[model samples]
Target: MNYISAEQLTKSYGVKFLFKDISFNINEGDKIALVAKNGSGKSTLLKIILGREIADGGEVIVNKDIQVVLFDQEISFDGEDSIEEFMMKLDSAPINALRNYHQSLYSTDTKFIEEALAEMEIYKAWDLENEMKQILSQLKINDLSVKMGMLSGGQIKRVALAKLLTETRAEHRHTLLIMDEPTNHLDVEMVEWLENYLSKEKITLLLVTHDRYFLDSVCDIIWELEDQKLYVHNGSYATYLENKMIREENLSATIDKANNLYRKELEWMRRQPKARTTKSKSRIEAFYETEKVAKTNTSKESLELNFEMKRLGKKILELRDISKKYGNTIILDDFSYQFQRGEKVGIIGKNGVGKSTLLNIIQGLENYDKGEIETGETIRFGYFSQKGLQYKEDERVIDFIREISDNFPLANGKTISASQFLRLFLFDDQTQYSLISKLSGGEKRRLHLMYVLYQNPNFLIFDEPTNDLDLPTLTILENFLAQFQGTVAIVSHDRYFMDRIVSHVLAFEGNGKVKDFTGNFSEYRQYKSQQEKAGISETEKIAEEKPQTQKSKKRLSYKEQRELEQIDKRLPEKEAQRQIVMEQLNNETDYEKITLLSEKLEALTSEIEMMEIRWLELQAVLED
Candidate 1:
């Protein structure tokens, strides 16, 4: 049953309609990901659903007993409240119990103290405290007792999440947790932990996020908000993308057929002689109607971007025995890597793992200690920082672009004007003169991107370029990056962007090591998984390898030893059965055969899960 439904939803901001006539449904246990670019009404729609904001015109129907928890990116807590205090306030029972307990401490009368104790017993306040503490401990927020006002944005976000996790109503049916960019300020480890938690939980989640890895791991359905409509696909983000492409292809084919028919009709009309007869007039009218219908079905003209670069020297940049130290912390220790021209690379790590630091060092924006940094003489670099475009508060948008374009001349041997550049970036006359301070986050980012491309550098480095971009812009950028000829190095949490653009991945592992793999994000994940299976230490991999230490021995403890033996014992049997089921599923066309194969696969999966859990237990014991 649909837990929430929006019919003919229309939202407008001033003269612009953010979205119109949009309709979709969210059911219980559904994990939906709303993906769109900035200013695409994703947040607005969420607000509408939550009744925080009213749509211009629409009927929103929410099922009875459905509780929603919305985590807005702009959420802020007031001053002087500790994390514990805030959590208690989210659920009044805990707060009331705490209040009574405090009151009892001050009370001299035994009757009042006894009553307070009875109240605490009834509310189970001790259990709530224990659960809250456990949650804090799991989130690594135990030592953080600072007031909410004192916490960093990332820390506050964590505290908010912890409160939500602890304060959930036990009796609430069909709860929907809505999160907007929840991963934005989270560290890599925190994101992974959240993904694991969400995957294990049996709750409905509707999240709008740019974090592709999080989406891929957590979301089973993708709700793409594009062209003022919501498109639902039942699968992971990657599968959704594949299916969307197929749909677009089909649309293209339909348009092509219509165009072909229209052309044939035009040819037929041209071949016939003009007559004053009634039959000829009727035929002409019918042709005009068909032509109008064909025109309506035609595809819009999309921008064609091509990034073709000249061949560069073999070594674009190289780092040898590089170690970067900030205060007493060592971020990169004796890290060595080489970037070759025409190579597309992605840099990934948990937040604060020095991904940005490495990018800055490569861009020559910062210096590193104890390392030799080398770059090809002919290398022209383009850098897009994670902070995106930084402009003075009072700076005008036109002035910003003109300043960047001052060095470059237009095609007619004239100085490139700000208006011309703005048009290229999709900002028209009205927006050109607007204050940079007033521009949306996405607009500012787009301006920076326009500047980067206008520079026409050979080597490009982007740090989370997709952070605030809307879905349409992201699609355009993806296509542009795919065809870009220069060497590109990117640091992004968007796995889809990384998979589509990068050819290799350089993952930063904290404590002075970076793992280098010669493939995209998916391939790098596979490599990491293999490394984990082989028991390769990331720290050891980062350090310079000696001839003797290169071929490291794999040491297994007693527990691991037993588990490995069991896995070996079970593999052949499972593999034989798995192969037989796969063959049957592949050959079977009937529904019943397919259903039976699916059931067999499900059973096999259950067995695999059990084995994996047992193996993990053994590994944990071995590590201990």
Candidate 2:
């Protein structure tokens, strides 16, 4: 049975066309992933289907007597309220009854949590509130006593999602789940868990997510929204890729024929007078339609990476006797390693197990409680972080990019203007001057990434860089990083990306247990599964076991420790110099001199982190 069907859907914003006569239907057991680039009307179409927004033409017919649960992209709470209190407010029950229902869930006061599930066997009202807690816990939001307002962006998104899943899973009636970017704020572990849950559940789901792994694992069907049209692929993600490749081959031939017809029509139009007759007018409209199809750039062009960088020296980075603590919680302890050249390391861990903290410590953005770090003299770094590049709302794309370097040097030794460089990253001529705040989330991420490359750092550190970015951009970035010459470190939850880009893994187990693995995430999972099935703890084999040293080994000399302390002072100085050079590049007209100085300044900025680390690997080896 069909749950919903949208027929001849047409919508537009003034002169901008969003969709034209697009149609699709949802079946009773379909798990669909809606894929599209940023600002391509994915969210708009979802709103139209939910009846929150009206399409200019056509109608959506949802099956009668079916419950619809939605998890919107943007959801907010009005005022301060505890999580428990918030739940009670959402329900239309009496205070005492709602209180009992809330308390029975995951509370020691009663075994009523299970009893509520038994009560829900008859589909009672109270079970909705209590039964949903199972989902909330699985989503990793367990603290009910916490205030809703205190939740982080990711936490709030999880709360909204938990509510939606619980609502849909509560009753046995037909239901539809419409989710927008459902995996946007999820970690890898949580994303995997949700994927498993959705794959087994009977509810019909339509969700928009950029995580390719989630799409592949959970969805049985894929709906690609492109060029104001919908293309349905009735299989898995791999099948969708295979089918789309065939469709594109056919489309290219059609486009070539249309282009030829459009050119002939254009030449004929220049010779003929303005057509007033109905037949001639209809013919002119046909020419215009063909021209539009030929000129569409959507999904036709992919972004390119043009990286021209300085040579990497023998020295890279070293971490020795490094330890970090937040109050009483230990993060990293006496970690020691020497980063070699051309190594791609992917860091994996739970939400707060200090993967990002380790990156920050290496980048000299954060301080450690103990230990020293080392760096090479010629090292330059490009850090692409989720908290990257804070741009003012009024800032233009070109203007922001000019701050890093007014010119980008190509491998052929030719230089491109800042605006031209931005275009290569998919920013168009008109969009170069558009306000930063007006861009989509993925666009903003792309813009930030452009600035990261603008510095021309030889080394790169990315901390959760794929969070809000679309899949195409991620694909291009993966290709770029795979070919990059310098050492790289990634802190990402996108497991597919990790497998593709990195050769090694740094798996961070909780409680300051860090281990090095030899292969990609998939291999690590296989090894972990084998260990689990054999009744062996993963720690016994994989923990970062300190090498046994002789008792005669000497500790760090007083001079070395003092030099490590001086790194705390020198790092700030180098950072200040990089900022000054960046400002000068914005105003300077001398492109040649500016580019050289910008590279030197960036190298200096990275040296601050490297300076302190280089001390640990110096002539004195502090063996423990």
Candidate 3:
């Protein structure tokens, strides 16, 4: 059943066209990822379909039986309300008894609390509050007393997510969720949790996100917005890439034919007399139309970086015995590493494990508690932070570019005008005079990036560079970075971007522990998993090697011990099965088969974990 169907939809921003005559249907149980470049009306389409924005032509028809939840770009909270109050306000269909019960937990109002629990049991919402708390804990939101308005952007996003994913809804009908950049402020763990929830939940989702790993894992169908039209591709993100390649290939061949036809028509027109005959005039007009289309239909040009990069010396930045602490919390302890010349490093950690702090220390803006730092003779640095550029509201785009530099002096001694550089980043003649405030979030990020990279620094530092960027822009940025001659140290949670860009990683485990991983995120995750299994297996073998005590009376009988040993054997088999299922998940193209296998894998994983606990219990008993 189709949850939402958009037919012949058209939209425009004054003289700038967004998409026209676009048609698509979103079915129930469909996890569709809408991907497009910045300012390409991906969000506009969602708004129109959700009835928040009006379309220029045609309409979006949503099924009357379904409910829609939108996790919009901007999250709002009411005045002077606690976290629970704000959550309950958004969850409008709240159970009165449950609400009172939650409030009662922090108070001594015992007269009514017990009665509310009884009422909750009547509705079988006995576990509802506990479930909500568990979700909050997973999201790292522990302080319930904090006001909604006082929370940071990331925290507010998390609270909003908790409301959608964990809060109770009215019974009966299913809900269709539409989100815009839902993974914007999320760390990798949070994104993984959301991915599992969305993929396993019995809800339909339409979301726009730049996290390629999240998109590939959660979405089964991809809707690509390009050249003012929607192209729908089935299967995973990998499949989408395959389809896009095929489409571009076919389009390239068609354009070649058009170009051939265009050249022949040009010759005929040049040779023909300047006659006002209908046949001659008609052919001339047709020739112009074909030429216009052939030009418009051609693929976008790649970004070229002619960086005037500073020369790097052999002694690159190095740190020995670096330590930092904030009050009672230790962020980094006894950390030491020597950054090599032309090294591409990825910095990864949870929300507050000093990723940005480390960058600040490197730039000499923040002092470490204990550290000996050394830098090369020549290492000019440019840092692109997630704290987005602060532009004057009235400042024009070209003026801002000119502020950075009037013209770029390439490393090879070539000069390009500031306006020409703007054109390279997709700002055109008309947009040169446009106010900074007019740019989309992603466009603003791109402009900020231009400001950072055009400075000709040999060392580049990027903090959460993927935040508001669309995937296409990210691809361009990746291409630009690939050609860059500088050393880069990036702090980003984007697994795909990290894997593509970096050669090594600084993995921040919690509690002032850091692991130096010599590979990308995916490779490191796999390596860590295998190491953990091996460690556990080795520990078990050493226990078996130990001699039995002389006075030992078996606390656990021989049969129970045998059962536990058998469990160890079965655990590895189940783990192997899990790996096989995961490999199938990565390779499988059929949706139904993928769904069934995913469910089976989830169940099998849960059972294995439970059995491992049982095995531990039996081991403890025997040892005692």
Candidate 4:
């Protein structure tokens, strides 16, 4: 069964032709992945199919009965409702019934509760509610009562995803799931969980993502959009790559053959006079067709990075007894490590586990509570963070880059102009002069990366650098980092990129525990799997053995004892703060102020819980 069919699709933006006369079909059970460069109209095609956008000269026919669920990169919400209220607004009967059931649990009216219960049973909303809760929990959305306005950008994306997935299941219709950059802003563990979930579910899917491991596992067909054309490969990502190479090679060879024939025809035409016979006219027409193929461009635009850094001294970065925390939440505790001159380390952990915080502390953007950090004189840090580059929206892309440096120095001492540097990063002449606000999200990320590389620093620190980047850019960046001469510390969720770039891994376990492994991410994963199979839980093992060695091998230091005392003093203050915020929320009538007070109350509650847990641990140590 065909879910959607598009014919002769032609679209353009200003003077640029995105695609011309393209045709495709999304059949039932087709798990497709659309791959393309940053600005290659992948999202636009999806919009056209979903009837959200109109094409210049084409029609998309979608089955009226099939349900389409789009997980777009930019979700639209007014940011005024709680998560439960937001979900209840969806047009799913089960969702509405479940919301009523939950509300009745808090109601004092017995008649309302009985009616709600009957509706839940009729709609089978109990199972839907359980599944929604599970989805929210796995995505790390613990506070459903919190307003949507209080969430971060990443958290908002996660919430949108959970809502979409739950809604699709509840509707009980034939689902055609379409996602754009679904893995963005997710940690590695979350990505893995999503991969597993999608692979197990029997839903038709079409998504645009740069996660190669995910594509290889979940998608069976590859849809490549390039050069105003669509090429379909009926296999996995690995097979698509191999087949694409073969196809390009064959096209080049055919073009070369056409050029030879066109040259012979040109000689014949130059020697003869104007043609009068029908046979001569046909030969002239054939000559023009041959010439067209001969002139086909086979050269592809590629991203190139070959910049050398300043010489590194013998002394590199070193941290001693580093400890950081917010109230009682420990980010780092006595974390000590000496980074070598040319080391590349990958940081891996769940979200909010202090990976980005560690990078900020190393760069001195954030302060540590207790630590001594030292760096060599030759070290110049180039930090690319998740906070992203702050740029004037109206400024031209070229002007933004030029503000950094008009010329970028290469490894061989040759310099390239700002325009040339932008071109190397796949920004064309027209795009260079365009406003930054007009660029795509991936394009902005690529531009920021170009700015970071232009500085020519000896030490590089990147936080979530692969979040919005396309696959081609990621491939070249990985190659460049593999040969980079300076030290690199990267916090990325891209497993393929991490496996290719890093030599070691730093696993940021929660509660200030950091485990350093002398191997790449793949190797570390294998080691972890082995440990799990052998029934070894690191946290459980540590808990079991800590009491025996608490007084002898490990004792609370002066700073730790002071930290315990501070937590004791702050717990009561945090509880009082929570009480005040709750009262303020009750008295507040303005929606905005209520949202703020609710956020404050949630923060205080979390802080108090952590402080109480830390206080108990400290007491246990003292008793030991």
Candidate 5:
């Protein structure tokens, strides 16, 4: 069944056309990804389809029978409302019933609770409510009572995501889910989980994201919006790329032929006398058409970075047993690493796990409690943050860029004006003159990146720099960083970006622990999976390999030996309990009981895995 069909859609901003006379169809179970350069109307197209925005010309028809859920890039809410209250505001029958039922559990009003309970039964929202709780839990939204204003942008985005997913799953069979930049604020783990969830579920989806890895894994169809047109590819991202290259190459060859014919036609026209003949007039018209095709650009242009980096001394930056804490939470503990002259390290972990804290400490922006930091005398630092570019709404893009420098110096000692530099980053003359508030999210991100690179710092620190960037800009940035001759450190959730730029990975496990691997993100993930299969964590394996200070290796204590024996004895019992709960879950017809049994089974399985890992740790200690 076709959920949506768009015909001859035309949209433009100001005098610039975003897409013109574009037609596309979204059918049932079509996992489509919309990709384009920044400011190319990807989000605008989605808005038009959803009726949030009007198209200049053309029509969009959506099946009224199917439920539609949108996870927008921008989230808005009443600041005073709590998370639960915010969820209740959604005009979804099942969701409103579920939210009211949940809110009633914290109330002392018996009559109100009874009414809410009756409504819940009418909607059969018990299973949905349970699923909602699980979704919130996995997204780390623990405090449903927190005021909307108290949450950070990332937190708000997560809540919006939870709400969208819960609604989608509630109407999973008949839902058409549309999301824009859904992975922007998500961590690597969360992105991976979401990728798996979307790929495994039978939900129709259309989303715009710069996360190529997620797109490759979750989407079976790719839509490329370029030059006021839409090109559809019926395959994964990799397949789309391959086909796109072939298309570009064929276009290039065709253009070359056109150019050759245009030269001949031009010579013939020039050789003809100033006499007006019907045959010559017809030939002249044909020549003009040939010239048009000859002048057509074969592919999108990408800028190459050849900027000279500042000299780095041998010492570089180093942290000696650095430790930091905020109240009871330890952000970093006894962390020590020396930066080499030219090294790129990617930092990844769960949200609020000290990845940003580490970057701040390295730059001396944040102080550490128990360690010393050293930096080379000649080093210069450039920091790009997740907080993004802060500028007055009325400030022009060119003015903001000019604040850095009127002239940007290249590697060959040549200087280009600030306007030229902005153009290199794809900001046209009109766009550069426009106010900052007029730019798209991706456009703003590109400007921010241009600001960072203009400084020409020898040491670069980027925190979630890929949040609102489009794929083409990401590719350019990745290529620039990969060729950079400076020391680099990044904290990002973009797996494809990390894989392309970084040479090492730092896995920040919570509680102030970090595991370093000398490989790219993909390699690190593979190594981590292997370690987990061997009953060891990445941190444990790294710790075991560290140089020993004492002549004798440490042995398991008496208490540890007893604990190991206890784990061995408890494992079988927990496994048996898990089996019993699983069987009950399969046989239970009661929705409430099934939810309870599933939770019990999950907990039991986690306990058993913990015991087994403990057994392995204990055995390793004894062997040492």
Candidate 6:
């Protein structure tokens, strides 16, 4: 059954239509992703559905007994209220009323009190309390129970989410939960916990997020709001993308065929050599009619983003033992790193871990204490600050781009046309005239990206570039970054974006120590896990094992001795062979030669492995 339905829904702010003629039906057990550029009315549409905002023109039909919960980005907590009190506030009126009635009856009649108590027990208030405790514990928010009202924004969001989840579970309600940018303030572990919970729960969800991993893991459908319309694509975000491309290709072919027919009609009309009669004029009109239909069928072309940076010397940028201090707080300490030419590095850390500060220092926008920084002669850096161009509220979009373009030389040695350049970034026609203040967050981000790309810098630094972008635009940005030839450094909390664009990860844990991983975010996580396992203290392991070091030594004696001798003899040969293979692998472009060398290396490795196995067997025999 359709739980909620919207038909002919239209909304606008002044003369601009946020979205119009949107119609879709959401059923039970549906997990839908509401995706659009930031400020493209995603929040407004949610409000309209909740009846908090009146739609300009639409019919919203909701099923009876349907309950909706919305998690907005701006969270407000009552300072004087306790966490328990807040949870109670989220409870349905009937639940509260029933509890009150039961308490009153408990003083009146013995039988009534017994029955009321039974009802309360069946309602599972005890289980709700326990579940709340468990959730708070998992989120590490239990410690903030007493200070919930005074907690940071991120902490408050977690508290709100906990209350929301508790209320829905307590009521045993089939509810539709709307979340807007819920992952914005969540840590990776918290996000994983949320995803796991949502995946197991039985609730209809409509979420707006830039977190691609969350979308792929949680949503079964994607409702893409673009160009004043809603495009419903079934399946995960990845599947939606694949299907969208197929649809675009089909549309392109149909448009091409239509254009050919229209051209043929025009050619025939020109060959008439006389003023067109009514029939000929009608045929020309028919051609235009066909063209109109074709136009409607055509998909909008994506912006052609060609990012070419001038070649820089081998040493693009280097930071030697960099450190930064703010007041008494140390943001970065002894962080040494280097970015080589063509290296795509991603910077990740918890909020306020100096990811942005490091980027600023690299870009020469900020000064750092106790560090040596170097840049290549041909290296040019472009910085996309977190605020982007959104901070300039009064500026027009075209004027902003025009001002930035003044520093760059055009193709003909003339000033670059602001309108033309902005159009390449998907600000076409009337959109060029839109005020920066009026533009959506995603639009402002795109404008900023265009500005950075126009610089033709060899080194690009983006701070949370995917924050408010739509899914399509995010894909476009991902493609551009993947194809970019220059060194790129990005500070993003979006794991999906990081994984797609970066080949290396620079994680800034607190205390100024940075860890560099050779692969993307996912790979970095795996590497971190391995390091954690390897760091397990011997004392802890001993506590779980037989006490004496003598027993351990005796158990390992023979194998340890044999392996020690084997390693002593084999190490030099293995090292020599490994070095030779590495050198050849570096220069050998021929796949067949590389494959042969890899096989030979594998055989050498197996011989060392066999020696270790034999040594282990000898150790076991000696112990016996």
Task: For candidate 6, write residues 530-595 as lDDT tens digits.
Answer: 546667443453364433334545556654653444354344345445555666678999999999
Residue pairs in candidate 2 whose N, alpha carbon or C atoms collide under 3 angstroms: 373-612, 373-613, 373-614, 374-613, 374-614, 375-614
Error of 5 at 46 (Å): 1.3
Worst 10 residues of 4 by lDDT: 545-554
lDDT of each: 0.74, 0.76, 0.80, 0.84, 0.84, 0.74
Q: Clashes in model 1: which pairs?
A: 36-471, 37-470, 37-471, 38-470
TM-score ranking, best first: 5, 4, 3, 2, 6, 1
lDDT of 2 by residue, 1-624 (tens): 988899999999877677899999998989999887666788789888888899999989988878677888688674487766665554323333455555676577556776554544444655565566777887788888899889988788888888677656544679889987787677777888888999898879998877788888888889888778899988787898888789888888888888899899999777877646788788888989999878755344444445577778888998988999898888997776668898999999887779989999998989999899988888888899877459887888788888778998876778888987776666777678888888877788888887887788888999888877776667767877876778999988888888888877788877776766555777566655655676767454333222212211235456555454444333433454555557667888888988887887677667755775675564246544
lDDT of 5 by residue, 211-306 (tens): 999999999999999889999999888888898899889989999999999999989988999986998899889999999999996545566767
Candidate 4 local lDDT, 1-624, one digit each (tens): 899999999999988998999999998888899998788888888889888999999889999889898998878876889887776777877877887888898999999999899989999998888898898898999888999999999999999999988987899778899998889888888899999988888879998999999988889999999889999999888898898899999999999999999999999889878755788888989999999999997766554556657889998898888999988999998887779977999999999889989998888889999989998889899988776668987899999988878988777878789998888777888999999989888888888888888888889999988888888778767877877889999998989888888977889988998876655787677766656776867777557544544442356776576566456434543554455567668999999999877887787687788888887888787777
Candidate 5 yields a Cα-based lDDT of 0.84
Local lDDT at 591 for model 6: 98
Looking at model 5, report the run of 10 residues with the lowest lDDT sum. 545-554
C-alpha positional error of residue 71 in candidate 3 after TM-score superposition, expressed in Å: 1.0
Go through the candidates in order and give the C-alpha RMSD of each one to the true structure: 10.7, 12.1, 11.1, 14.4, 11.1, 9.4
Q: After superposition, which runs of candidate 3 have C-alpha atoms over 4 Å from their true positions?
A: 91-94, 103-119, 167-171, 270-285, 297-299, 536-624
Better of 3 and 5 by TM-score: 5
Supply every candidate's count of residue pairs whose N, Cα or C atoms clash at under 3 angstroms.
4, 6, 0, 0, 0, 2
Model 4, position 334: C-alpha lDDT score: 88
Question: Where is model 6 poorest over a 10-residue stretch in terms of lDDT?
Answer: 541-550
How does each model score on TM-score?
Answer: 0.71, 0.78, 0.82, 0.83, 0.83, 0.74
Considering TM-score, which of the candidate structures 1 and 2 is the better prediction for this target?
2
> How far does residue 433 in candidate 3 sit from its true spot (Å)?
3.3
Q: How does model 2 score by TM-score?
A: 0.78
- In model 4, which regions exceed 4 Å deviation? 106-112, 266-281, 301-305, 535-624
* lDDT score, candidate 2: 0.76
